[model samples]
Target: MDKEFTPRIAAILCQWCSYTGADLAGTSRLQYPTSIIAMKVMCSSRVDPVLLLKAYLSGSDGVLLGGCHPGDCHYEVGNYHTRRRFAILKAVFDTLGLESARLKLSWISASEGPKFAQVANDYTEEIKKMGENPSKKKMFL
Candidate 1:
């Protein structure tokens, strides 16, 4: 791999939970990869399938969806909805020839700053190993 090759990751973080966790990671000065571009949403369930696909097509090497833990969502059932949606999204990604590893979902609470940093580091490395998004390359050419 080229030394300059850096993966591009699109991260959708639940505003009430994962986003707060990420902010904590930042304030705590935890080191993580800088490859991710994060967007905060009211709930993880709000991350539409099209949005994930579009992110890949637009050159993101991976997509990460972070939300509250299964039973602790601020909106009660929001994380549950996210879980179901991600399962379907995974199947869609498979059907579209996208590797399942390139799309990930995690439950990160507001108190899990270390976990957030670790996730960022780990996902960045995973995306780097996967290289670029082939579909994006083809579409761009």
Candidate 2:
């Protein structure tokens, strides 16, 4: 088993919930992998599937989509929109032979800061096991 750790991860968090949770994580001083690069959006629905494509095309090893846990969207069902978009996005990744494991979509509320940290750590570990994204080399080379 050839295993190496590449910790570059792009964390796209909804301004409503996940972002708040991330803030709580900081206030609580919970330490997860610092590999996460956070990008905030007013709504998770605002995260276009194109961004995910662009991230992997650039240099991101993983793209983590976090939202308000389905119906809890502050924008009212914004998370639903995100969920549907990612469903198709994941399918596209599969069709292109890009490792779908590199993309993650999760529902975490503002109160669940510890959960947010755990998710970040868990996803990071998962992607680390998968190694670098194949799309990175395929697109660049």
Top lDDT hit: 1
Residue 100 local lDDT, model 2? 81
Candidate 1: where is the Cα deviation over 4 Å?
Answer: none
Regions more than 4 Å wrong, model 2 = 1-4, 139-141
Per-residue CA lDDT of model 1 for 1-111, tens digit only, reads 656778888999999999999999999999988897889999998888678867767778899999999999998998898888889988987886768788889999999
What lDDT tens digits, residue by residue, belong to model 2 across residues 61-139? 8999899987789988888888989999999979987778888998889998999999988998888887777656674
lDDT of each: 0.88, 0.87
TM-score for each prediction? 0.93, 0.92
**Candidate 1 least-lDDT 10 residues:** 132-141
